[model samples]
Target: AQSVTQLDSQVPVFEEAPVELRCNYSSSVSVYLFWYVQYPNQGLQLLLKYLSGSTLVKGINGFEAEFNKSQTSFHLRKPSVHISDTAEYFCAVHEGSQGNLIFGKGTKLSVKP
Candidate 1:
């Protein structure tokens, strides 16, 4: 069994301010982690992923995440955020392969001026 918790329903941050979106996952076996961002009416975009090897993974839009296997946590972070960065973020996990997948409710990021 696998599940995801976003921890926050919403995150507010000023433009150019650093932001971090916390995510925690639980699973019975090894799984792949991913962070996806969905703007307005667009489809979900791959933010970053943690498969193996490096603990730190970088993605588009200057975003990065560190994979912590001990704690089973993979939190996404951005040094500086822009106004356009406002969107809905989702943390997902694929158990073993891409067959069984679980996703968090979502965390809406509101970037103010």
Candidate 2:
């Protein structure tokens, strides 16, 4: 089985400040990893994904994350964030054949201006 855990339930940062969102996962088999962002009253959008490649993966809006196999972690980072980046972030895994996602409770990012 595969499961994900997000360390922080919320992170409030000022505009243009650096931020890091912690995430960890456990799986007996191989799995696809993904991070999605959901703004208020809007659907989720793909932030970034780690299929199989270099440990470092970059996504839209200047966000990036590194996959650490030893720690079983995939932590998101941004050098600087904006007020518009405020949203709910979910760390997910797709280790099943049906392609259903197992999402973490969620990390709320509150970007203050």
Candidate 3:
């Protein structure tokens, strides 16, 4: 069984500042990595994903992540964040094509102006 670990439960950043949310996973086989964000009172939305090919993948809202197979880590980063960026970010991995996904505890990104 695979599992994801989110290093931090919450991250605080000032508006227009860069931020990184750490994520790590453990699996015996290859898996698909993804980052999803959920704003207050909203459902989760895909932020980025690493299905295959490139290790570096980009996603909406200027968010990007690197898939480091060696380390089994996929960390999400935003060069500059806005107050509107405040949300809960989740790191998830899907094994095989079962459509069953294992998600991290989630990291709440607090962007203060």
Candidate 4:
């Protein structure tokens, strides 16, 4: 079974500042990685993925992450963020066999303008 752990439950930052949200995963087999964002009661939107490529992957809203196989980490980062970036971010892993995704509890990003 694969699982994701979001180290930070909440991250508060000032507007236009850099931010980083840590994510770690444990999987026995190869897995598809994803970062998703949710605004309030809205559904989640894909931010980025580490399907198969370079270690670095970029996503919407100026966010990016590096897939570290050894560390089993896929941390989200942004050089400069906006107040609107305040949302719930989730790190997920999909097991190919089960065709299901297991998501982290969530990391609430609060950006103060």
lDDT of 1 by residue, 70-111 (tens): 898999999999999999999999875547668899999999
Q: Provide TM-scores for the models.
A: 0.94, 0.97, 0.97, 0.96
Prediction 2 TM-score vs. true: 0.97
Candidate 4 regions exceeding 4 Å error are: none
lDDT of every model, 2 decimals = 0.92, 0.93, 0.95, 0.94
Across residues 1-113, which tens digit of lDDT does each residue of candidate 3 receive? Answer: 88999999999999999999999999878789999999999999999999899999999999999999999999999999999999999999996667988999999999998
Ranking by lDDT: 3, 4, 2, 1
Stretches off by above 4 angstroms in model 2 are: none
| Model 4 local distance difference test score | 0.94
**Root-mean-square deviation (CA) per prediction:** 1.2, 0.8, 0.9, 1.0
| Overall local distance difference test of candidate 1 | 0.92
> How many clashing residue pairs, candidate 2?
0
Error of 4 at 20 (Å): 0.5
* Best-matching candidate per lDDT: 3
Give the Cα-based TM-score of candidate 4 against the true structure: 0.96
> What's model 3's overall lDDT?
0.95
Residue-wise C-alpha lDDT for candidate 4, range 19-73, written one tens digit per residue:
9999999986676899999999899999999998799999998999999999999
